[model samples]
Target: MYALVDCNHFFVSCERLFRPDLRNHPVCVLSNNDGCVVSLSHEAKILGIKRGVPLFQIADIVKKNNIAIFSSNYLLYSGISERVMKIITDTAKNVDVYSIDEAFIDLRNYEKKELVPLMRLLAEKIKKWVGIPVSIGVAPTKTLAKVAAHYAKKYKGYKQVCCIDDEQKRVKALSTFDIADVWGIGRQFSKKLTSFGVNTAYDFTQKKEFWVQKHFTIMGVRAWKELQGIPTINTTEINRKQSICTSRSFGATVTDIESLKESIAHFTAMSAQKLRKQNSIANIISVFILTDRFSKQEEHYYHTRSMALPVGTNDTAELILYAHQLLTELYKRGKAYKKSGVILSGIVPNSSVQQNMFDNLKNREKRSLLNKVVDNINSKSGLNSVKYAAQISTDKKWTTKTSFKSPDYLTNINELFEVH
Candidate 1:
């Protein structure tokens, strides 16, 4: 059996963790640059404030309904995520962290009768210790566990934990589960299934294997098998990405060369950090810039440039240097660019990278040590506390808007919650 533990209204819950007074109030968390609604409390959803609706569109409702709005604070979310994952790892020995807000725990060793009580206890423990509500769903497969999790969160009768340990339970759950919301079934498949009158998960599984093979392919078959209580998906650590890209739409468009270069430097540095985190190095760096997509054909501008490195490296300075060069080539004068990014590709494990015979080994080691120091300092002091000067802008016109951002309560010592 596999148990999937998912946080309930994660971002809103995180915001409420500090301000207990907001627990019963309407709240909505915005995406980067406070662009749109990404997470909402039940009260917010009850007000018909849909996800991804721009902040401007909901101004009237927010003012009238008194909805608490906030900008996304990734640092706080990630810190709390690490703490939550730690508690899970300590309790469930075999666990796969599915995402920041979810994890799958292997439960095959436990007796069937112990599943619900143990999961319920775990949920209560998390609430008691971390002050965050979680829903746990246990079943024969990850996909079924996901379905069980939805029920666990939806109905208060389950006490935040649901189990589909028997064939009867599995069938009932699949019969009611929306085919579109089933794990691995996207919109395209959902529309296709709907056209064929396959509205529920049980209906999808009833289709012939050859029909599934011809229409939905291997992935769809995998989901079909998973929904039927057959385990096909690996609940192991996810594979590392072959490439890392970091890009952001600016709060306002920038046209100057210096501001654009600063943005590119920031993105390249971030991509390099991710490469180091995964213990990988990149052999190629690519940079791209874009003007407003809605602009006139003659006004819009977009271009990309990539360069292959002589040797793979995760050094931030080296990557930024290359990215600046690429950006310089891609940038065009008089174009109001709204977004830009850096992509690090041709990745290989840092330990396995071939050393360039012409490269200075000592200097490479020095750069690596320097990066490690910076990373350690930033990790301790909060992100970008010790960043390169090139990442800082005087006017700060291209920076993300965080007007409603909350404090970094978990990550920063000074911002820790106060008690009287």
Candidate 2:
């Protein structure tokens, strides 16, 4: 059997993790730049406040209703996610982290009598220890496990546990759920299914495999099989990332080439550290810059440029040089730039490559060793221990807005909040 565990109102839950007083109150976490609501608590949802509603539009409503708002604190959220997943992994024989707030675990080894209680215990432990409430669903397949999780969350006093081990319960759950609620059914497919009088999970499951495959795509076929209690997907262990990129919007629009170069260099250094963390090297580098469309100015621009390396490298200096070259080509002098980013692509595992044959530099080995030493020092001491000339400015105009942001709580000393 597979068990799917999903956290309830994840971002809101993360906020509440540190401030339990926020429970039973309307709370939301805003998106980057505090532009819109990205996550909302159940209380906020009950107030008819929908996700993605712009913050400015809902500011009056939020203030009048005494709603609590927080800026996105990814450092805290990611740290909490890692802790919660570790708890689930310790309990389950096998666990696959489906997302930041959801995971799938294999529970076939446990007896039916032992499964639900253990799942309930696990959920309670996570809530007690990690300050996140979780809903769990267990079934013969992953899709049904997802369905079970939805039901587990819909009604209270299920103790956050829903199990579909028996045929009767499975049939009843399928019959009550809408066709669109099924795991992989998109709106268009759901509409087509409704036309065929298949408006629920039961209706979709009742169709033959051949019919599902003929009318729908492979995804549909997989969902169909999963609904019929067949395991259509297998769990794979999560591996380290191949590439990482960090990009952000400017605090104010910038039009100068020097300021743009500074932003690109900072982002490039961050991306290089990320690459070094994965013990990988990039074969290509890309830089992108764009202007704000909302600026009332008629001249809006977006451009990206990428260059391939003569050989794979993870050297921050070399990466920044190439990034600056790309930025120079892409940046126009008079146009206002709102955002910029650097990406290191074509990443390969450290063990995948052989020494280059074409390069004739006698000090190539020395350069590689020096790069590794620089990475180690920067990683221990904070980012940019070794700075680039372009990023020498003490004040950065392109920083993100995080006025209402909570304490990092897990990372950063200066940003930590304490209640005296």
Candidate 3:
């Protein structure tokens, strides 16, 4: 059996962990620059404040309903995620961290009768220890465990844990679960399957395997088999990401090329950090810029350009120089760019990279060591504690708007909770 343990309304829940008064009120966590609603409390959802709705569009509802709002405080979220993952690692023998708020646990060795109680205990322990509510769904496969997790979160009576350890329970759950929401089923497949009268996960599983293969190919067939309690998906850590891209919508429309360069440098530095984390080097670096799609006043511009490196690198300095070169070519005067990003691709393991005997890769060993030193310092201190000179210097010029962000209570010593 595999159990999918996921935090309930994670961002909002994280906010509520500090402000208990907001526990019963309508609340939401906005994306960068407070652009749109990315997460909300159940009360806000009940009030029909849809996810991804612009904060501006819901101002009336927020004002009338006394809704609490927050900016995306990634520092806080990341700290809390680390704590949650630690608790899970200590609880389960084998675990795959699925996302910031979810993990897949291998519960195969446990006796069938103990699955429910053990999972329930794990949920309670997380709530008590981490002060974050989680729902657990145990099943024979990762896909069904995902479905069970949905039920655990949706229904109150499940006591925050649900398990489909038997065939009957599997049928009952799959029958009511929407096909579109099933694991591995994307929006396109969901629409096509619905058109074929496959409205539920059980419906999809009922189709002939060859028929599913004909329409949606082998991947869809695997999803069908997974829904039927057969484990086709392997839960393993991804060794390397195909591409590393770091981009964010600006807090405000930026008109200056210098400020846009700062954003590019910062995002490139971030991509480099990720590349190092994955123990990989990138052979290609791409830079792109965008103007607000909805703005009628500004002419639209969206373009991306890429260049292959003579030698792949994960060094922040090397990546930033290329990023600046790309931005210089791509930036246009009088264009109020709303977003910019850096993408690094053609990645290979840093250890496997072959040194060019011909090309004088200036102090390659020194650059790699310097990156390690900076990463360690930043990790021990705060995010980007040691950063490239090209990145933004002043906190005031920070690209993303976090006007309503909560304190970094967990990560910062000064912000730690105090009692009177």
- Which predicted model would earn the best lDDT? 1
How well does candidate 1 score on lDDT at residue 14?
93
TM-score-wise, the better of 1 and 3 is: 3
lDDT (tens digit, per residue) of candidate 1 on 166-261: 889988988998999999889999999999999999999899888888988678998988987889987442446788889998889898989998
**What's the candidate order when arranged by decreasing TM-score?**
3, 1, 2
| Residue 254 CA displacement from its true place in model 2, Å | 2.0
* Model 2 Cα lDDT, one tens digit per residue, 1-420: 889999998989988877878888999899888888999998998988999999999888898999999998876786788889999999888888888899999987888899999999999999989889999999999999999999999988677999999889999999999999888789999999999999999999999889998899988998998988999865441235555677988878887888888888889888887777667888889999999978786667888999988778777778898999999899787887889999888888777654677854457568778877887665444446667687777767787787789886766677665776
**Lowest-sum lDDT 10-residue window in model 1:** 233-242
Candidate maximizing TM-score: 3
Lowest lDDT sum, 10 consecutive residues, model 3, at 391-400
Q: What is the lDDT for 31 in model 1?
A: 96
TM-score each candidate.
0.92, 0.83, 0.93
Model 1 deviation from native, Cα RMSD in Å:
2.3
Candidate 1: regions farther than 4 A off: 235-239, 295-298, 348-352, 360-373
User: For model 1, which pairs clash?
Assistant: none
- Give the residue spans of candidate 2 off by over 4 A: 186-198, 235-246, 265-284, 309-321, 343-356, 359-393, 415-417
Better of 1 and 3 by lDDT: 1
